[model samples]
Target chain A: MKTRYHIRPRHNIRPQSCIYALLASISVAVFSLPNAAHAAGTLAGTDIQNVASATFDTAAGPVTIQSNTVTIKVDELLDVTVSSTDPGDVITSPGQTSNVQRFRVSNTGNGDEAFALTATVANGGDDFDPSLQQIVIDANGNGVFDAGVDVVYTAGVNEPVIAPDQNITVFVITSTPAGVVDTNRANVSIVAAAVTGTGAPGTSFANAGQGGGNAVVGPTGAQSSASGFLAVQATSVTLNKTATILDPFGGNRPVPGAIVTYSLVATVAGTGLLNNLVITDPIPVGSQYQPASLTLEATALTDAADADAGNFNGTRISVAAGNVPAGQTRTVTFKVLIP
Target chain B: MKLIIRIMMAFATLTGASLAVAATPLQLSSDVFVERTIEGVDGTKTVVLEKPKMVTPGDSLVFVVKYKNVSATTATNFVVTNPLPPAVAFNGTSDGQEIVSIDGGKNWGFLGDLRVAKEDGATRAAQRSDVTHIKWNLNQPLTAGAEGKLIFRGVVK
Candidate 1:
């Protein structure tokens, strides 16, 4: 039997197999697509270049990190400029004197960042009122002074956002009172956010921000009130002899015609007021009293209120007998002619 | 097998729809902190300029306070209350300034107008010392990382 079996064509297609292949392919595609997108969009670590850093030189040197991340860099420079102009072009006048000071702040940063600016009246004597002063912000970052751009003034508070490489102006004015001294100074500081990098130029890798610059007010009137409390203080008091003849022979060698001068000094302390006060130093029993010629000399005397007891004029007084009010304890410099 | 393929396609489509619905990006970092510092004084606590280290009688002092927004979302309906310490007097302007009695932690308005009967059957109006606290109402919202400061003055003893 020559059996030539009829070769039937095998239908190899299976619905389940097709489905499994399709599902596996779809999963692979979905996972791979995201990986590719992330690789394309994500910034590489090397792309960020920390340029420079700035440090805040405060009364206390470098400040410790208050937070984990530092906010200021040392490489960055902040320019704080101030200018004042009296409305009438004359700073001194009798009428309503309005002086406007313009403060310009600019940041030289490589990236777009926000900065905090703080303006303070530095060591302003009792005369200046920080509360009365006005502070305006030009939100547009323009250097010009414009109406309606006035920002509310708050002492010791940081101003609004300052964009990088941009400038902002702050105006300060004072109304001078009659016969009052109009002197004031302002300090402006820019607190830059911290950047990255070590040993880099201005790279403040530490996230702690830093401050810079001091601005001062221009010319004004004098202080009006003399009622300010005065405290006199002194570092130290010292006594010195201008001329001392050293006796090489050792004994109390009283050389003939040799004159000895005794001087007593009362130093004024910086903390208190030494008003028309009198000072007297008693002569020791061993020292002889020279009544003929008694002289008083003072290094500094601002007013004519000081007067010697006996003499109407403040110069010198003659010592007659019992403790002289003017010459009792004062520094007595006399020429005691040796016998 | 065909059913399995169909199920896989459906799952992918569902995931796609969900992703589309939830595709909001993280706009800000978590570390931003907006802060404000205010300078002011409470009653009884006399802060002197010369000897700021100690509080004394008949002394003028300054009070400083700081406010910060630490939340990820904006903070709204903010209120701060500070009480006048005993033996302290408020300076010139008191507008927008309130007095409180609840130890400076709670808010109170004028206490002089309100009278409460005591156990002795006597009615007494609140005095300055009875002020529970002072409050500042900021109706505006504070955005994330925003800060502010406030200041005031007071005289002691």
Candidate 2:
């Protein structure tokens, strides 16, 4: 948008002067609000000075007198904010180890201060308690976690000291034990507090601020906590076998040279994915092997150990169902003759 | 007794002002204090002013300007002006006759009658944060040895 300024011609002011006035006013309006609304309020140790003046008429002449200046130094505010970095409940399998729930701690105060960190996994409202491992900080300041790079947090040791408006990422490591039912959730929480002190708002710690000024707790009470949970999804597989007999005498009796058909159905359960699932069945003692009779999900397989998932040795049949999703079933059928 | 002593002092000052021919006779002084609410043992709360030792953001402060006329004659056309500190935002004053400046003392008027220029070449109703200075006029003449104080409130930005 273009702005047009109409200057009265009778004022005898030059056009260039008008342009300068316009620019000066525009700059002042744009820069004034941001300087007043700084998020981290005024910096500590800032001296604010004020003076008052008065002018009055005297019998001899007009006179003006100014007052002495009074100065006040700003004190520091101690506040902290903690929030969960994870989008939602983290998905994990039973017996999973070293699963991490992330949280970010920020220093929302106007001073340089150290924060003490604490984590708890044995929360009462959780379905199953996850064993507490250790709390670690993002040592390199990177969002991604590195096993050996990140620093493990210990009480009164290696605490992070952040500047005003700065944040640090923290990870809570825990392990889920076996036997925990599927769809169960375990919550973990972390708390970060100013090492100086924690108390009600306006509570002041004398001479504890960055520049030796008093430190007063802000609205956050100088400490904060955030929670994240882990959801369990267990996986397993089950197989069933059935056999049918057909005799040459047109009877369903167990006779010699009777053809027998065997079917094996494998079904996977739970919400997790099962890996390296293999099914094997040995040939019966009184049965003769039928050539090219092995089929997986109604697909034929050779009697050799080839690139296909199905293979048959002299005495047994095997099918490698690499990965199987939950609620899925696979059937393998083979024919055998009773010699 | 205190009031009598104060009045006697003012008379002595007036005598001295008459002897001096060139002195302006008007004296100004400023002070800042913080207000805190204290609860009494009987469950009554009272606000008390104390020296600001730990001033933080969003804290309320009171600025007082005291003026006195020490000359033998009445002082007329007396005006007091105070420019707010950069780190403080004007909160209001108990006196309704005061005029405020929003453009660094360039213009002055009642707060409700003032307009602030915006960067978009538009004007907006002046707000508390836009106040840059405050002024009060003593409409009546200040007689010899007369004294009074003016006050306004502000908050740390």
Best by TM-score: 2
Q: Write the per-residue lDDT of candidate 1 for residues B1-157, one digit (tens) a residue.
A: 4335644653553354345333211111111111223346643443234423222223354444446555455645444433333233333213535434432333245554555456789977754434423445556665667766444455432
TM-score of chain A of each: 0.28, 0.84
Best by lDDT: 2
iRMS (Å) per candidate: 32.5, 14.7
Task: Point out where model 2 deviates above 4 Å.
Answer: A1-31, A34-36, A57-62, A139-142, B1-24, B39-45, B71-76
Worst lDDT window (10 residues) for model 2 chain A? A5-14
True contacts kept of each: 0.00, 0.59
Q: How does candidate 2 score on lDDT?
A: 0.79
What's the CA RMSD for each of the models?
Answer: 30.1, 10.9
DockQ of each: 0.01, 0.27
lDDT of 2 by residue, B53-93 (tens): 99887888898888888778887778887878766789988
